[model samples]
Target: MHIKNKLSVAIILALTLGLAGCQSAYYKTMESFGYHKRDILVSNVEKARESQEEASEQFKSALDKFSALTGFHGGDLEDTYERLNDEYESSEAAAADVRKRIDAVAEVGNDLFDEWKTELSQYTSSKLRNDSRVKLSKTKSKFKKMLSAMRKAEKKIAPVLNVFHDQVLYLKHNLNAQAIASLKSELSNLETDIGKLIAEMQRSIDEANAFIKDLKKQ
Candidate 1:
Protein backbone atom coordinates (compact mmCIF):
# COMPACT_ATOMS: atom_id res chain seq x y z
CA MET A 1 0.00 0.00 0.00
CA HIS A 2 1.02 3.61 -0.52
CA ILE A 3 2.41 5.40 2.53
CA LYS A 4 -0.41 7.96 2.60
CA ASN A 5 -3.06 5.26 2.50
CA LYS A 6 -1.31 3.39 5.29
CA LEU A 7 -1.32 6.52 7.41
CA SER A 8 -4.99 7.04 6.70
CA VAL A 9 -5.73 3.51 7.88
CA ALA A 10 -3.71 4.13 10.98
CA ILE A 11 -5.73 7.26 11.69
CA ILE A 12 -8.96 5.32 11.36
CA LEU A 13 -7.64 2.69 13.71
CA ALA A 14 -6.48 5.28 16.22
CA LEU A 15 -9.90 6.93 16.12
CA THR A 16 -11.62 3.62 16.56
CA LEU A 17 -9.37 2.81 19.49
CA GLY A 18 -8.98 6.15 21.26
CA LEU A 19 -11.54 8.65 20.05
CA ALA A 20 -10.90 11.34 22.68
CA GLY A 21 -7.14 11.01 23.24
CA CYS A 22 -6.26 10.64 19.57
CA GLN A 23 -6.21 14.36 18.74
CA SER A 24 -2.44 14.83 18.64
CA ALA A 25 -2.01 11.43 17.03
CA TYR A 26 -4.83 12.12 14.61
CA TYR A 27 -3.18 15.40 13.61
CA LYS A 28 0.18 13.76 13.16
CA THR A 29 -1.28 10.95 11.07
CA MET A 30 -3.15 13.37 8.84
CA GLU A 31 -0.04 15.51 8.50
CA SER A 32 1.93 12.47 7.46
CA PHE A 33 -0.76 11.77 4.86
CA GLY A 34 -0.09 15.26 3.43
CA TYR A 35 -2.84 17.26 5.19
CA HIS A 36 -1.36 20.32 6.85
CA LYS A 37 -2.45 22.15 10.03
CA ARG A 38 -3.74 25.17 8.13
CA ASP A 39 -6.04 22.93 6.12
CA ILE A 40 -7.38 21.33 9.28
CA LEU A 41 -7.76 24.72 10.93
CA VAL A 42 -9.95 25.96 8.10
CA SER A 43 -12.10 22.84 8.29
CA ASN A 44 -12.49 23.20 12.06
CA VAL A 45 -13.44 26.87 11.76
CA GLU A 46 -16.13 25.94 9.27
CA LYS A 47 -17.46 23.31 11.63
CA ALA A 48 -17.59 25.82 14.48
CA ARG A 49 -19.47 28.28 12.28
CA GLU A 50 -21.93 25.64 11.16
CA SER A 51 -22.53 24.59 14.74
CA GLN A 52 -23.07 28.16 15.89
CA GLU A 53 -25.51 28.74 13.04
CA GLU A 54 -27.46 25.64 13.97
CA ALA A 55 -27.50 26.69 17.59
CA SER A 56 -28.79 30.12 16.61
CA GLU A 57 -31.62 28.57 14.64
CA GLN A 58 -32.51 26.17 17.41
CA PHE A 59 -32.71 28.91 20.02
CA LYS A 60 -34.89 30.95 17.69
CA SER A 61 -37.17 27.99 17.26
CA ALA A 62 -37.43 27.58 21.01
CA LEU A 63 -38.34 31.23 21.33
CA ASP A 64 -41.04 30.85 18.72
CA LYS A 65 -42.44 27.78 20.41
CA PHE A 66 -42.54 29.53 23.76
CA SER A 67 -44.41 32.40 22.15
CA ALA A 68 -46.89 29.97 20.75
CA LEU A 69 -47.34 28.49 24.19
CA THR A 70 -48.26 31.91 25.55
CA GLY A 71 -51.08 31.97 23.02
CA PHE A 72 -52.02 28.42 23.88
CA HIS A 73 -55.60 27.78 24.93
CA GLY A 74 -57.80 24.83 25.84
CA GLY A 75 -56.41 21.90 23.89
CA ASP A 76 -53.88 19.16 24.78
CA LEU A 77 -52.00 20.79 27.65
CA GLU A 78 -49.74 17.80 28.14
CA ASP A 79 -49.03 17.67 24.45
CA THR A 80 -48.07 21.34 24.40
CA TYR A 81 -45.65 20.95 27.27
CA GLU A 82 -44.13 17.95 25.51
CA ARG A 83 -43.50 20.00 22.38
CA LEU A 84 -42.03 22.95 24.28
CA ASN A 85 -39.91 20.61 26.36
CA ASP A 86 -38.64 19.00 23.19
CA GLU A 87 -37.62 22.38 21.85
CA TYR A 88 -35.85 23.21 25.09
CA GLU A 89 -34.02 19.90 25.03
CA SER A 90 -33.07 20.39 21.42
CA SER A 91 -31.81 23.90 22.09
CA GLU A 92 -29.71 22.60 24.97
CA ALA A 93 -28.22 19.94 22.76
CA ALA A 94 -27.46 22.48 20.03
CA ALA A 95 -25.67 24.69 22.54
CA ALA A 96 -23.61 21.74 23.66
CA ASP A 97 -22.72 20.97 20.06
CA VAL A 98 -21.56 24.55 19.56
CA ARG A 99 -19.22 24.28 22.53
CA LYS A 100 -17.91 20.96 21.27
CA ARG A 101 -17.17 22.44 17.84
CA ILE A 102 -15.35 25.40 19.38
CA ASP A 103 -13.23 23.02 21.42
CA ALA A 104 -12.32 21.10 18.29
CA VAL A 105 -11.24 24.31 16.58
CA ALA A 106 -9.09 25.23 19.57
CA GLU A 107 -7.52 21.79 19.65
CA VAL A 108 -6.49 21.91 16.01
CA GLY A 109 -5.30 25.48 16.45
CA ASN A 110 -3.16 24.57 19.46
CA ASP A 111 -1.72 21.61 17.61
CA LEU A 112 -0.87 23.87 14.71
CA PHE A 113 0.84 26.36 17.03
CA ASP A 114 2.89 23.72 18.82
CA GLU A 115 3.98 22.28 15.50
CA TRP A 116 4.77 25.73 14.16
CA LYS A 117 6.91 26.54 17.22
CA THR A 118 8.88 23.30 16.89
CA GLU A 119 9.39 23.79 13.17
CA LEU A 120 10.76 27.28 13.87
CA SER A 121 13.66 25.67 15.69
CA GLN A 122 14.66 23.85 12.50
CA TYR A 123 14.91 27.03 10.40
CA THR A 124 18.47 27.86 9.31
CA SER A 125 17.52 31.47 8.61
CA SER A 126 16.83 33.45 11.76
CA LYS A 127 14.92 36.10 9.80
CA LEU A 128 12.36 33.62 8.44
CA ARG A 129 12.01 31.92 11.82
CA ASN A 130 11.50 35.21 13.62
CA ASP A 131 8.97 36.32 11.02
CA SER A 132 7.07 33.06 11.41
CA ARG A 133 7.12 33.44 15.19
CA VAL A 134 5.65 36.93 14.94
CA LYS A 135 2.83 35.66 12.75
CA LEU A 136 2.12 32.81 15.16
CA SER A 137 1.99 35.22 18.08
CA LYS A 138 -0.48 37.42 16.24
CA THR A 139 -2.67 34.45 15.29
CA LYS A 140 -2.70 33.18 18.86
CA SER A 141 -3.79 36.56 20.17
CA LYS A 142 -6.63 36.78 17.66
CA PHE A 143 -7.69 33.24 18.48
CA LYS A 144 -7.81 34.03 22.20
CA LYS A 145 -10.10 36.99 21.60
CA MET A 146 -12.35 35.06 19.23
CA LEU A 147 -12.58 32.10 21.56
CA SER A 148 -13.58 34.39 24.43
CA ALA A 149 -16.38 35.90 22.38
CA MET A 150 -17.62 32.46 21.41
CA ARG A 151 -17.64 31.27 25.02
CA LYS A 152 -19.41 34.42 26.16
CA ALA A 153 -22.22 33.72 23.72
CA GLU A 154 -22.27 30.12 24.83
CA LYS A 155 -22.78 31.21 28.43
CA LYS A 156 -25.81 33.24 27.38
CA ILE A 157 -27.63 30.06 26.46
CA ALA A 158 -27.69 28.75 30.04
CA PRO A 159 -29.87 31.49 31.50
CA VAL A 160 -32.27 31.21 28.61
CA LEU A 161 -32.39 27.49 29.12
CA ASN A 162 -33.17 28.03 32.78
CA VAL A 163 -36.13 30.22 31.86
CA PHE A 164 -37.42 27.60 29.47
CA HIS A 165 -37.03 24.88 32.05
CA ASP A 166 -38.97 26.86 34.63
CA GLN A 167 -41.83 27.51 32.24
CA VAL A 168 -41.94 23.94 31.09
CA LEU A 169 -41.96 22.58 34.61
CA TYR A 170 -44.62 25.07 35.67
CA LEU A 171 -46.80 24.05 32.78
CA LYS A 172 -46.25 20.39 33.57
CA HIS A 173 -47.65 20.76 37.09
CA ASN A 174 -50.33 23.40 36.49
CA LEU A 175 -51.67 22.57 33.06
CA ASN A 176 -54.76 24.67 33.54
CA ALA A 177 -56.28 27.96 32.44
CA GLN A 178 -54.83 29.73 35.49
CA ALA A 179 -51.29 28.63 34.63
CA ILE A 180 -51.75 29.92 31.08
CA ALA A 181 -53.00 33.23 32.37
CA SER A 182 -50.05 33.62 34.70
CA LEU A 183 -47.63 33.02 31.85
CA LYS A 184 -48.86 36.14 30.06
CA SER A 185 -46.94 38.41 32.41
CA GLU A 186 -43.85 36.27 31.92
CA LEU A 187 -43.92 36.74 28.14
CA SER A 188 -42.12 40.06 28.28
CA ASN A 189 -39.23 38.61 30.24
CA LEU A 190 -39.04 35.67 27.88
CA GLU A 191 -38.93 37.96 24.91
CA THR A 192 -36.13 39.99 26.45
CA ASP A 193 -34.06 36.92 27.26
CA ILE A 194 -34.53 35.51 23.80
CA GLY A 195 -33.52 38.82 22.27
CA LYS A 196 -30.37 38.97 24.35
CA LEU A 197 -29.53 35.37 23.53
CA ILE A 198 -29.91 36.01 19.80
CA ALA A 199 -27.85 39.19 19.97
CA GLU A 200 -25.01 37.39 21.72
CA MET A 201 -25.20 34.57 19.20
CA GLN A 202 -24.91 37.03 16.34
CA ARG A 203 -21.87 38.59 17.93
CA SER A 204 -20.24 35.21 18.28
CA ILE A 205 -21.02 34.41 14.67
CA ASP A 206 -19.47 37.67 13.57
CA GLU A 207 -16.34 36.95 15.56
CA ALA A 208 -16.11 33.51 14.06
CA ASN A 209 -16.38 34.93 10.56
CA ALA A 210 -13.79 37.61 11.20
CA PHE A 211 -11.39 35.13 12.76
CA ILE A 212 -11.84 32.66 9.94
CA LYS A 213 -11.01 35.32 7.38
CA ASP A 214 -8.07 36.56 9.38
CA LEU A 215 -6.44 33.13 9.69
CA LYS A 216 -7.19 31.57 6.30
CA LYS A 217 -4.25 33.58 4.95
CA GLN A 218 -2.00 31.27 6.94
Candidate 2:
Protein backbone atom coordinates (compact mmCIF):
# COMPACT_ATOMS: atom_id res chain seq x y z
CA MET A 1 0.00 0.00 0.00
CA HIS A 2 1.29 3.43 -0.90
CA ILE A 3 1.88 5.72 2.08
CA LYS A 4 -0.39 8.40 0.57
CA ASN A 5 -3.24 5.94 0.09
CA LYS A 6 -2.83 4.63 3.63
CA LEU A 7 -2.90 8.16 5.01
CA SER A 8 -6.00 8.92 3.03
CA VAL A 9 -7.69 5.85 4.45
CA ALA A 10 -6.76 6.86 7.96
CA ILE A 11 -8.00 10.38 7.45
CA ILE A 12 -11.29 9.11 6.01
CA LEU A 13 -11.79 6.82 8.97
CA ALA A 14 -11.11 9.64 11.40
CA LEU A 15 -13.51 11.92 9.59
CA THR A 16 -16.15 9.19 9.49
CA LEU A 17 -16.01 8.86 13.26
CA GLY A 18 -15.37 12.48 14.27
CA LEU A 19 -17.66 14.14 11.73
CA ALA A 20 -20.43 11.59 11.66
CA GLY A 21 -23.06 14.27 11.99
CA CYS A 22 -21.32 16.76 9.67
CA GLN A 23 -22.11 15.72 6.12
CA SER A 24 -20.39 18.72 4.57
CA ALA A 25 -17.13 18.03 6.36
CA TYR A 26 -17.34 14.33 5.57
CA TYR A 27 -18.01 15.05 1.87
CA LYS A 28 -15.13 17.53 1.74
CA THR A 29 -12.78 15.00 3.27
CA MET A 30 -13.91 12.41 0.77
CA GLU A 31 -13.41 14.86 -2.08
CA SER A 32 -9.87 15.48 -0.89
CA PHE A 33 -9.24 11.75 -1.28
CA GLY A 34 -10.31 11.85 -4.96
CA TYR A 35 -13.83 10.64 -4.23
CA HIS A 36 -15.96 13.43 -5.63
CA LYS A 37 -19.68 13.91 -5.03
CA ARG A 38 -20.66 12.12 -8.24
CA ASP A 39 -18.87 8.96 -7.12
CA ILE A 40 -20.43 9.23 -3.68
CA LEU A 41 -23.85 9.70 -5.21
CA VAL A 42 -23.46 6.57 -7.32
CA SER A 43 -22.30 4.57 -4.32
CA ASN A 44 -25.20 5.82 -2.24
CA VAL A 45 -27.67 4.90 -4.99
CA GLU A 46 -26.28 1.38 -5.07
CA LYS A 47 -26.68 1.16 -1.30
CA ALA A 48 -30.23 2.45 -1.48
CA ARG A 49 -31.08 -0.12 -4.13
CA GLU A 50 -29.61 -2.95 -2.09
CA SER A 51 -31.44 -1.77 0.99
CA GLN A 52 -34.73 -1.77 -0.88
CA GLU A 53 -34.08 -5.26 -2.15
CA GLU A 54 -33.36 -6.49 1.37
CA ALA A 55 -36.40 -4.69 2.67
CA SER A 56 -38.57 -6.34 0.04
CA GLU A 57 -37.43 -9.75 1.15
CA GLN A 58 -37.83 -8.93 4.82
CA PHE A 59 -41.38 -7.77 4.27
CA LYS A 60 -42.14 -10.92 2.35
CA SER A 61 -40.81 -13.02 5.20
CA ALA A 62 -42.90 -11.10 7.67
CA LEU A 63 -45.97 -11.58 5.51
CA ASP A 64 -45.37 -15.31 5.29
CA LYS A 65 -45.11 -15.54 9.07
CA PHE A 66 -48.22 -13.48 9.43
CA SER A 67 -50.12 -15.67 7.01
CA ALA A 68 -49.12 -18.74 9.00
CA LEU A 69 -51.19 -17.53 11.92
CA THR A 70 -54.34 -18.37 10.00
CA GLY A 71 -53.62 -22.05 10.42
CA PHE A 72 -53.20 -21.95 14.19
CA HIS A 73 -53.91 -25.45 15.56
CA GLY A 74 -54.06 -24.78 19.28
CA GLY A 75 -50.36 -24.85 20.06
CA ASP A 76 -48.47 -22.40 22.34
CA LEU A 77 -50.16 -19.09 21.60
CA GLU A 78 -47.45 -17.17 23.44
CA ASP A 79 -44.77 -18.71 21.26
CA THR A 80 -46.73 -17.90 18.16
CA TYR A 81 -47.22 -14.32 19.27
CA GLU A 82 -43.50 -13.98 20.01
CA ARG A 83 -42.55 -15.22 16.54
CA LEU A 84 -44.92 -12.81 14.82
CA ASN A 85 -43.70 -9.95 16.99
CA ASP A 86 -40.13 -10.73 16.02
CA GLU A 87 -41.05 -10.63 12.34
CA TYR A 88 -42.81 -7.31 12.78
CA GLU A 89 -39.77 -5.85 14.52
CA SER A 90 -37.45 -7.16 11.81
CA SER A 91 -39.62 -5.61 9.11
CA GLU A 92 -39.55 -2.30 10.95
CA ALA A 93 -35.76 -2.38 11.11
CA ALA A 94 -35.50 -3.19 7.42
CA ALA A 95 -37.84 -0.30 6.57
CA ALA A 96 -35.72 2.05 8.65
CA ASP A 97 -32.59 0.93 6.79
CA VAL A 98 -34.28 1.52 3.43
CA ARG A 99 -35.24 5.04 4.52
CA LYS A 100 -31.72 5.75 5.76
CA ARG A 101 -30.12 4.60 2.52
CA ILE A 102 -32.52 6.72 0.48
CA ASP A 103 -31.65 9.76 2.60
CA ALA A 104 -27.93 9.16 2.01
CA VAL A 105 -28.50 9.02 -1.73
CA ALA A 106 -30.51 12.26 -1.60
CA GLU A 107 -27.82 14.04 0.44
CA VAL A 108 -24.95 13.13 -1.86
CA GLY A 109 -27.05 13.82 -4.96
CA ASN A 110 -27.98 17.32 -3.76
CA ASP A 111 -24.37 18.11 -2.96
CA LEU A 112 -23.15 16.79 -6.30
CA PHE A 113 -25.66 18.84 -8.28
CA ASP A 114 -24.97 21.97 -6.27
CA GLU A 115 -21.22 21.59 -6.76
CA TRP A 116 -21.63 20.92 -10.47
CA LYS A 117 -23.81 24.00 -10.93
CA THR A 118 -21.41 26.16 -8.94
CA GLU A 119 -18.38 24.99 -10.90
CA LEU A 120 -19.98 25.85 -14.25
CA SER A 121 -19.15 29.50 -13.63
CA GLN A 122 -15.44 28.66 -13.31
CA TYR A 123 -15.30 27.37 -16.87
CA THR A 124 -13.92 30.04 -19.21
CA SER A 125 -14.74 28.18 -22.42
CA SER A 126 -18.32 29.00 -23.40
CA LYS A 127 -18.78 25.76 -25.35
CA LEU A 128 -17.45 23.60 -22.51
CA ARG A 129 -19.59 25.45 -19.96
CA ASN A 130 -22.74 24.88 -21.98
CA ASP A 131 -21.87 21.21 -22.41
CA SER A 132 -21.34 20.81 -18.67
CA ARG A 133 -24.56 22.63 -17.89
CA VAL A 134 -26.53 20.37 -20.23
CA LYS A 135 -25.05 17.29 -18.64
CA LEU A 136 -25.90 18.64 -15.18
CA SER A 137 -29.47 19.24 -16.22
CA LYS A 138 -29.83 15.75 -17.65
CA THR A 139 -28.33 14.15 -14.57
CA LYS A 140 -30.58 16.17 -12.30
CA SER A 141 -33.62 15.15 -14.32
CA LYS A 142 -32.75 11.47 -14.08
CA PHE A 143 -31.97 11.76 -10.37
CA LYS A 144 -35.32 13.39 -9.69
CA LYS A 145 -37.14 10.57 -11.45
CA MET A 146 -35.25 7.95 -9.47
CA LEU A 147 -35.75 9.78 -6.17
CA SER A 148 -39.45 10.07 -6.81
CA ALA A 149 -39.73 6.35 -7.38
CA MET A 150 -37.78 5.67 -4.21
CA ARG A 151 -40.02 7.96 -2.19
CA LYS A 152 -43.15 6.37 -3.60
CA ALA A 153 -41.90 2.98 -2.49
CA GLU A 154 -40.94 4.42 0.88
CA LYS A 155 -44.46 5.73 1.37
CA LYS A 156 -45.90 2.24 0.90
CA ILE A 157 -43.87 0.97 3.83
CA ALA A 158 -45.64 2.96 6.53
CA PRO A 159 -49.13 1.61 5.87
CA VAL A 160 -47.90 -1.96 5.88
CA LEU A 161 -45.96 -1.34 9.06
CA ASN A 162 -49.00 0.14 10.66
CA VAL A 163 -51.05 -2.93 9.86
CA PHE A 164 -48.34 -5.22 11.16
CA HIS A 165 -47.96 -3.19 14.33
CA ASP A 166 -51.66 -3.32 14.99
CA GLN A 167 -51.76 -7.09 14.52
CA VAL A 168 -48.67 -7.62 16.67
CA LEU A 169 -50.12 -5.50 19.47
CA TYR A 170 -53.44 -7.32 19.30
CA LEU A 171 -51.70 -10.70 19.41
CA LYS A 172 -49.51 -9.63 22.32
CA HIS A 173 -52.51 -8.71 24.42
CA ASN A 174 -54.81 -11.54 23.38
CA LEU A 175 -52.73 -14.62 22.79
CA ASN A 176 -55.67 -16.86 21.95
CA ALA A 177 -56.91 -18.86 19.00
CA GLN A 178 -59.78 -16.41 18.69
CA ALA A 179 -57.32 -13.55 18.25
CA ILE A 180 -55.49 -15.52 15.57
CA ALA A 181 -58.78 -16.18 13.84
CA SER A 182 -59.53 -12.48 13.88
CA LEU A 183 -56.15 -11.73 12.32
CA LYS A 184 -56.81 -14.37 9.68
CA SER A 185 -59.53 -12.17 8.23
CA GLU A 186 -57.05 -9.40 7.60
CA LEU A 187 -54.49 -11.59 5.87
CA SER A 188 -55.83 -11.07 2.37
CA ASN A 189 -55.66 -7.28 2.63
CA LEU A 190 -52.22 -7.47 4.17
CA GLU A 191 -51.06 -9.72 1.37
CA THR A 192 -52.33 -7.26 -1.22
CA ASP A 193 -50.59 -4.33 0.51
CA ILE A 194 -47.31 -6.23 0.71
CA GLY A 195 -47.60 -7.19 -2.93
CA LYS A 196 -47.98 -3.54 -3.87
CA LEU A 197 -45.04 -2.59 -1.69
CA ILE A 198 -42.77 -5.21 -3.24
CA ALA A 199 -43.79 -4.13 -6.73
CA GLU A 200 -43.09 -0.47 -5.96
CA MET A 201 -39.74 -1.34 -4.39
CA GLN A 202 -38.77 -3.29 -7.50
CA ARG A 203 -39.64 -0.29 -9.64
CA SER A 204 -37.47 1.90 -7.43
CA ILE A 205 -34.62 -0.58 -7.59
CA ASP A 206 -34.86 -0.67 -11.36
CA GLU A 207 -34.79 3.13 -11.50
CA ALA A 208 -31.73 3.21 -9.30
CA ASN A 209 -29.95 0.77 -11.56
CA ALA A 210 -30.83 2.77 -14.65
CA PHE A 211 -29.64 6.00 -13.01
CA ILE A 212 -26.37 4.45 -11.90
CA LYS A 213 -25.66 3.18 -15.40
CA ASP A 214 -26.51 6.52 -16.98
CA LEU A 215 -24.39 8.43 -14.48
CA LYS A 216 -21.40 6.15 -15.07
CA LYS A 217 -21.60 6.69 -18.82
CA GLN A 218 -21.11 10.42 -18.21
Best by lDDT: 2
Supply candidate 2's per-residue lDDT for 106.
90
Q: For candidate 1, lDDT tens digit of each residue in 77-158?
A: 9999899889989988998898888887887788788888889999999999999999989988988887888788878888
Candidate 2 clashes between residue pairs 3 or more apart in a chain or in different chains: none
Error of 1 at 164 (Å): 0.9
What 10-residue stretch in candidate 2 is worst by lDDT?
10-19
Please give the clash total of every predicted structure, in order.
0, 0
TM-score of candidate 1 against the unseen true structure: 0.88
Worst 10 residues of 1 by lDDT: 13-22
Q: What would the TM-scores of all predictions be?
A: 0.88, 0.94
